[model samples]
Target: MSRPARAHLLSLDEWWESGEDREVRVELQEGVRIVAPRPRPAHARVVLSLATQLSDQLPPGFEVLIEVDVVIDPNTPATVRVPDLIVRSTTSVEFPITADQLALAIEVMSPGSRRTDRVTKSSEYAEAGIPHYWIVDEDLSVTALKLTPGGYVATGFVGDIVTSTPWPMRISLER
Candidate 1:
């Protein structure tokens, strides 16, 4: 008889515990591993620009997080991530993001990052129950996505004018 497909299993807790010694950021979803490269200068610029703009517009008690790991669970499938920009309305923000704490997550697509963002992370964020997830493509000049009960659905594309409110007020994205 053919051997059953060999399977390797790891609790999500182990994944988070292991990330401390790794070189780059790693996240897990249902025990699957994901790795992403460090941001390039242009990518960094976009993240910083958007972070600054959002920070300025956000009201008190809310804050913008930059390149920090957002832990999505505390159980065996504990998923952790470092999104480009995370806007939280909570007075205190901490790691291990639960379903309710996370308000919005924005990812700036890097070269060749379309598949990962549009597919992998998209599914994972939805599973994590993050309210709003936006994927920003530098080349296409587009900010796309809308969170739904199942996952993120590509609803609209903003080339020059992008408006949303993770914070109390509206913030726009140009270019």
Candidate 2:
């Protein structure tokens, strides 16, 4: 016997209402729901370290958040991403943040999240018009990117210290 055809995609409201209480991290991509496993120790550490460093350097009216849901599509609401860290101004008040209010989105790659972080999420954030995106690997190497008219372009990559634009901050991953 052959497998049956899949059902229709879930609307953003429908997906939000489903709300099955679980520990897994969930996101929506083009009306499809994606569930990610919990972060490992290395991922958590990087997130914490990056958030702390960025938070301290952010000027007034800008703040750093960790593991927050970012609504990438305003027209359709089909994609909701939970970036590992986000930097946005204080003007946003809603629970799920919209793309325009965000300055940067950062993702610390986990074993399971490498592909999505590097490819899928990067594309989505760029399409959403977020200015900056950073990816941190397990080894603490960082890739800083800026969204241009064409797409995301790598600005810098460093294993220890990273100083990039859009944010006047210097990050040191040295132990």
Candidate 3:
């Protein structure tokens, strides 16, 4: 089936009010709507487990948020991404928190999203200066990256316990 195409570039507000946003698993990146396949049951399970685990060990002042639209840039040609999880400051009470308030952005890799998570998102998150990014595999091992002036560098660990920064909290997602 053909998806309906919008002619104009979308801002954050337009994407929110446009009923199309509610009708699908869509992300708006640089003003275009990107539709992704529904996540499989196993993928959803990992996301849930991570959210619960992360929240339990969360440091003071930070909170773990499940799939919610993260406003990367609120301009007319907007960029919004809904990651599997986002660790953000508790200070921001808004529905879609801006990128600066994000401490870490986590992506649980689904089969269809491997490349997008590994390559595309890492670039975008770094550009947004989110500081840390976690790429969780299907088996639940995490590869964490730390942002630098140039880009993200692998901060991979030795075992099940993985830690990220802005604050130190060890996360064990091992099965």
Candidate 4:
């Protein structure tokens, strides 16, 4: 007997409808479906901490969301991604927020996601024209990047006090 062929990719709507009752986190990248591992305690801590800080300090028209799917390219539904946290304007709230509406996408690095966060996701976000991207390392160091005409440029790296542009907020990572 021959084995059945497997699906290598899923469109955004398909993935969403299929995953509605599932607990596993899934993301689509370059026409492929990827299963994301559950965040460990340390990773979850950073995610919540950052989300809380951003949500508390964001301006009136902006809001912070956790693990929300962002559609990088509506034409290619397989290009959806779920960032650890996203900062977006609240003026036009919508499900599966598009990349253009997002002000920032943040990823808390884990052993399994270091490369994806630093390289693949960075490139994707830049290509999608999201203005800002941040990577929070295991040690709590943060690397902030801003989108430019050429691509994403590292704006700053901070471990203690974080003060960056495009968002009028300061965060201290000291514990």
In TM-score terms, which candidate is top?
4
Off by over 4 Å in 1: 1-8, 19-22, 149-155, 167-175
Taking all chains together, each candidate's TM-score versus the true structure is 0.76, 0.89, 0.87, 0.90
Worst 10 residues of 4 by lDDT: 155-164
Runs with alpha carbons beyond 4 Å of true place in candidate 3: 1-6, 19-23, 157-159
Taken over the whole model, the C-alpha lDDT of each candidate is 0.69, 0.82, 0.82, 0.81
Clashing pairs in 3: none
lDDT of 4 by residue, 34-102 (tens): 786678887787888788778878889988889888888766446888899998888855876899999
**Stretches of candidate 2 above 4 Å error?**
1-6, 20-22, 74-77
Model 2, TM vs. native? 0.89
Show model 4 residue runs off by greater than 4 Å.
Answer: 1-8
Instruction: Please report how far candidate 4 places residue 59 from its true position, in Å.
Output: 1.3
Tens digits of per-residue lDDT, candidate 3, 1-175, equal: 9989758889888888875454457988899988987777888887887788778888888898888888888888999999989998898877768888888898989888899899988988998899889898876677888898988988655346545365656766654
C-alpha lDDT of residue 125 in model 3: 92
For every model shown, the clashing-pair count is 3, 0, 0, 0
- Cα lDDT tens digits for candidate 2, 115-134: 99999988888988999998
Error of 2 at 45 (Å): 1.2
Q: What is the alpha-carbon lDDT for the whole of candidate 4? A: 0.81
Shift in Å, residue 25, candidate 2: 1.4
